[model samples]
Target: MTSPLSSSPAWKALLAHRDALAGATAADHWQASPERGAAFTFPCAGLVVDFSKQPVAPETLALLCALARERQVPESIEKLFTGEPVNVTEGRPALHMALRGDEHAKVDGVDIRVEIQREREHFRAFVEAVRDGRWKGATGKAISAVVAIGIGGSASGPQLVLRALAPDHEGPQVRFAANIDPAELDQALAGLDPATTLLVVVSKTFTTEETMANALAARAWLEAALGPAALAHHVVAATSRPDRAIAWGLPECNVFGFAEWIGGRFSLWSSAGMPIALGLGMAAFDHLLAGAHAADLEFRSTPLERNVPALMALIGLWNRDALGAPHHVMLPYAARLEGLVLYLQQLEMESNGKRVTTTGEPLDRPTVPAIWGAPGTTGQHSFHQWLHQGTEAFACDFIVVAKAMGSDPDRHARLLAHALAQSEAFMDGLDVPDAHKACPGGRATTTIVLPSLDAMHLGALIALYEHKVYAQACLWGINAFDQFGVELGKTLAGRILPAVRGENAALTPATHHLLGIIHKLAQSD
Candidate 1:
């Protein structure tokens, strides 16, 4: 595969082709055919994705697919699924697909299927024991609340899943603490009895400072209230480093480990999602995995045009490369899916926000757009103003559910209508007489309409985006797995800790000055 540069033959063709398409608009495409929506739509894992609002002609779609082929996307995808070391810098395979409960997945001669299933069963038994009052704390009190401690993907993914599937919860109330700030953990523990609280500590290495601090603090709180033995009964871990967990005084049986092959952003499908299983029950969790597996199968087998992930990737590439969009926005109309944007923001930005290509050469093209968004109705009042008439261009995705769970029919109908209205308004902006009222209405959006918000659909939705990120990474020749960009901060923070405490001579002038101000403020306090 060749580097995807402006000078490449395929990219040059696309550049010339885009010039010819300069006059084309979303409105023009919509008006070209009444069946335009149907023509551009694809169904996968029970979600119907409508991409008609995107300004792409049939020829353009073909050319995009050709570009993908030119970049060897198919070969890349095979490497992704077959556990090749696609994460070249780290020399690890991004085999998150194995976490979706596939019974036949093998990576590096190890049957990941057996391992995943074993962990699933272990998770199920533990959840059942806790929920059924068989597993009690040191005080013999039934666990009533679970404090999930982790940061970033570890915390956000399960938090999102637990919140979305709360109705299916037959277990303890799940609370989340992701921040390094002590207040976050304190707030989560508020109103919950230490004797009845089980802390779930999650980190791949079991050494993330924020998570470990929160875990140890929670342990102290529990031990203070329930005695030292409470640590054994009240704390469990989801980690890839069981030896470290055991050394930290956690019982061997209480430590659940997943493969190191799972990236933190993609670890939710593994035992890192234990909190989700505990909150949503194993059945709902299974549905989530099954839904993702279904989407994965489709992504692996379907053609570029027919594949939902492929089309989404191509549209995203088109928006970035051809239309010159600098940002991507997500809007989920369902209130239950409020965390969707946060989850995807990390998934997209952390995965593909790279300046270099896979071959160690600097990339000349943009990788990922600045991904951001919030839930609808509330967002309608907040950032929708900028989305409507803002000067910057955006490639937006509006996710809606046809039948909302527990919502009144009229209210659900209104929600659906508002979602469609927003998409239409973006595509066909108001051409009113007043300058302020005019919406320069050619902004592109893709609407994802699900049958309803359920574990299955949510799983499929997340997996679709995962595959889409992979497809886009292939086109850009970047590794979507390794995240070296985030490590520098942690490294710097460790070196700065001593400076922040007192010493300023060893630090840079700017950092020393900042630390001096912080120390001065602290002494005043």
Candidate 2:
């Protein structure tokens, strides 16, 4: 069966162009054209993305943009901004863009701004009370720490942002627990004073197994330390199920509600960002939203060639499909952005890591590449050797801040040098006589340079990828918003839980035997 995407005129053009550029090195391309670097780089706000190191010519990019045109990407982006049901399978608009508070968007003829403004007021009042010591714990003491209980998007999104903006944080110390394993929660809550700790439980459904487990454990810990009545003073909920939150003994006033249309992975902009407002002030949070809004406007207005996110998406498609890259690495030089890859992994992989289209037809090409990486300088010691000399070729993105927040300009300069040197090294390798010292050149890398590691820049960086993922999904003819892929594992784990507990015998022998060994080990403990 012929796929619509592959059969498109633009796709045929790209395939022909790919064959025409076979065996051409990025270095060769650069040598042939003096203006390759300036010509390939694109800017959005203060962030500049240099995509020259990817194995793409001007014609390659033109053809990819043609593919986007054939796929009607601009129209899809319009649907995203206008709050149409872009997430067709789920029958929702995927309106996380509205949460950023710049668009005057209304879904289904209802003014969403009214509810958004109401929630913003609620967020500001609640955050100010907590951060200014006006909101006291049950013991009449001001809260000094916060424990965020969540899993997946609920846990990762706010936690990632909290870490990214750590240098700007002057409010309560923030902690996170996302695992069902008690050890993780124990470690996070180890030395905290329960009396002065506030728990923010974030689960859109109020029924995530790991999040609810951690939430219950947090409740028990707080009750054990501050009494059952203290729950009202210290616990708050960010969820769609406000009634369920209240039923769990949290006060109605402490329950924060966000719309169901806001998926967990894209939820940090919503009331799910309560912990963010508590850690960094609501003003800083507002700046973060404003920064993202700036990128949203750019994505809406900028042409595909000059659009940073669109260009990034086009380069990625070329690398994955045309260049046959199997893996992608995210190397961020800033220490504060340690969680950036974790956030992007979910954003990209969970959004596009599908084997089938929205209509359940099998895909002819790969979707999302396997994304993995760590913070650099640290990662350089661990994987740079393999990346430099390994047999496998992978596409990479190197993120660096142009300016450091603290003093010591020399250190920041060194970080910037490392980022540039790595990208350059990927293109220009040493040709040594000895095989051990020789390097294979022509790997692909995109360098993303942010003006600084401030919340605003970070917000723009994040929104850039959010739009890139959307663009890629549009090009691939798949829905970027739905994730039915994550449910089967959850369902299987639930089926296995009873067997592990020895409460039922309707289990596979292999699982039952494994449970016996686990149970036996537990008894010894």
Candidate 3:
């Protein structure tokens, strides 16, 4: 695992630029110099990225571009698109891109297009059956609602997509329960007919604690009303654990499996995307994949300086390391993209939130910042105050669809107005003589404008973030594929569960005292 950064001319150039940045201050440059913007070119998925707002100089941009070139980023992008093994730690090709239209990509001389087509056919059939009255519950009722149960990637992707594309939905209403909280499950199932609801359990392994717990709770609610036989009618699973699902009373036919090579966050193009497919239909799903593939083509063919993903990655590194920013915000103005912030939080943080690199060496640079954000109008009412007046220099993204999906013309105008207004405010702050009232005008912000809020644009938006994460991982010299950080908490929970159940032997004095207090409090309640 030789690092792409170490033995390359690009690395040397970047090092030189980094050194050059020390003497420059925010006071010296309030606006991004034209020379800086001219030094970088942007390319991706029919989207034009403007990275001129970043603090990087022309020399720095050239250095970053050289680093990307030295790292064989173009070749790596091609490898990823063609199903080569880029996920080194996992020893698998991250071929989520193949789930899109990879007609030219072949595995062992077998075209991936056929498999994708077959899977889509299966999805369409299932969706049509459910959408029409052809697929009936045991009680002979049409499904009026859907509950998607899963944690992390399984939950985040579909949940975000559904929320963003809600205006286009014409089928059953969909709800999601991903947390381990009983309250979330209770609320999701509340007022839903047991015989008229479908529960789509999504986990690569059908054994995720939160997903299974929520599934079982939903099952119990259904059985309490519709009887045990209703399990077959109410439950469907998107997982490789078909045996487990069958053993748990789900029909084998109801189990859908995706390949192990597809990471959860990237699995939306696979069967894990069934919920989204059902909500939006096969045409929209294909459009989503097509948009991603479009970006994939751009990323693979474009040069480093002209690469949108690479430039986005370099700008992020500049903000985090050079500009001393500790946070990155994803603020989409469209209410439909409300869940996008949460999706990106997991995608970026869980992928790169590491202290060590791929080969067990401690990283000298910061890995990931606190990735947090919300939708526009709501965020404006809440945390926009801190974002505007706060001392900390947080890097922010303002995402807006050029045109509103909503039919209300006045509402759409207001939405776009707020979107444009916020970015303007961030770039040119309010002025007051008093220190408390004075606003910092030089705060950095990036605006991502989409053509529209259709499935294609949303797909492109997500793919952009995905590629940006990949490029950043390459720059930081870490494996973005594996997530060992999530394992430690699972291990700790196993040890604590027995104690929680009062089945453990001698406890530590502190634990025993806490147990006594808990028991007393329980009795009092």
Candidate 4:
């Protein structure tokens, strides 16, 4: 039988190596290194990755790679390409790669090429119709605006892609509403005419509470404006359960479907990207897919010692498991990339934030760290102080773009400078005679340089992180695809909602007390 990950030889050797390197800092390696530490940077999928500031020695890397070999990271990657049901718990293959035109990708012994291509054509026809003014709203006017609705995976990925790729959107004006908050939908619908607006309701099951609530509200809003018959023309759906969507009032022509093998968080490349295609055009969307496919090739074929995502995953394991760091920060220099952090939070946390393994045994070591951060320069003002002097030990991933979204050379130059300066300050501290002025240095950071913020690069960046999440999950023996942990609260919320709506449902005393206060407050309204 295979040993537990904690008791494996490579893991034990690392534990010993951890004791061997005491009192050394990342700064120490920088000064004593050759080539001014330039060798630490690796060119990967069009980005330059520098791990010099991670505070790991050559021996540390060798041991970590050994651990990866023992964990069979390469084989895990192969299974993904070969369409194995790596997501064992769900009994499904997490083959989002098929969404990007992977010819060999499959599910249930059927190659997805023919099916995925057919779906792609259907997805394109709808998006092209809307973009080219061929599809009209209930009032027989070409759609000029869109309100995209869905929560979590259905929402975050496409929302971020459109924001990052199309800042000045020249196509149909697309606004996204993900939160169940009435204000979010209200804001998205504000000042837009129902006559010319289209709604893309994205949900895998077509019954997610938050998504359906928002979709129904938006449908009602449209019905009030254009009448009940108009919704057949006004609302479009991207879901696996087209029957539920059709039962809920969408026309059969308005429904687009993806396979059960696709997860929501990874669904942006699927029919979930309907909004992205409408907002950014099919050409841009295709470029995004191409970039991700390129990265997939790199991740699937590259050697373990130098693979980009593998290195990212291993270094992350070292930080969380060996150093005991509990959190990681992603600081993107471009503001449009702000959603990148939100997207990653769900990708890393929801995927690997588990207490149990794939077999349902307790996990012995830490997995993914709590992921959080804002866009840089802005983040510099918000959290730089704490990062520089805070008692907490955490890792930072900084994203630096060679050129920004704008054409102002001076502004981009200064933005790049600030990112570099902050990264340097993070790795090396200053000595001060004043006790209050001293800065704690030696914080580990990994800086990634994006060639530019185009669709291709953005796709590669997102896919790179996806593989990183998968690699870490493989190491932890966790089910990266299933999220049973999130289901209980949603189920309980379903039970609790009726009680809050004046029903005589039984409740805990504290909940009743809170509900009473809320009800009493409503009386004043």
Model 4 lDDT per residue over 59-104, tens place:
8888999999998888989998788888888888888987775667
Q: List the residue pairs that clash in candidate 3.
A: 164-336
Look at candidate 3 and tell me the lDDT of residue 24.
Answer: 52
lDDT of 3 by residue, 1-525 (tens): 236344456666666676877745333344445354444335467555655555566677777777666666666667777777677777777778777765567665667677667766776788889988688887999887899898899989998888888877888888889999899988888899888999999988788888888888888888999999988888888886668888888887787777767888888888898889778777888899888878877766667777777788877877786567899987888888888988999899988887776777877778678899889798999998988888787788888777757779789889889987877677667678898878776666767778888888788889988998888887777777888879888876776678777786566688778877887888894
Give the TM-score of each candidate. Answer: 0.97, 0.97, 0.91, 0.97
List per-prediction Cα lDDT, in the order shown. Answer: 0.88, 0.88, 0.78, 0.88
Cα RMSD to native, each candidate?
Answer: 1.4, 1.6, 2.8, 1.4
Ten contiguous residues with the weakest lDDT in model 1: 1-10
lDDT, residue 15, candidate 1: 78
- List ranges where model 1 is wrong by over 4 Å: 503-505
Give the alpha carbon lDDT tens digit for every residue of 145-258 in model 2. 999999888877888888888878999999999889999999889999998999999999999999999999889999998889999999999998999999999888999899
| Model 1 lDDT tens row, 1-525 | 537567677778887888998758879976777778778888999999988889888888888888888888888888888888888888899888887855475677776777777877887888889888899888888999999999999988998888777778878899999998999999999999988899999999999999999988988998889888778899999999999999999889899988888999999988889889888777888899999999999999898879899889988999997788999999999888888889999999999999988888888888899999888878999999999999998899999888866747988888788888998899999999999889988888999988988999999999999999999998888889988889999988989887766664378889877877877888894
Local distance difference test, candidate 2: 0.88
Q: CA lDDT of 514 in candidate 2?
A: 81
Off by over 4 Å in 3: 1-12, 18-43, 104-113, 430-432, 505-517
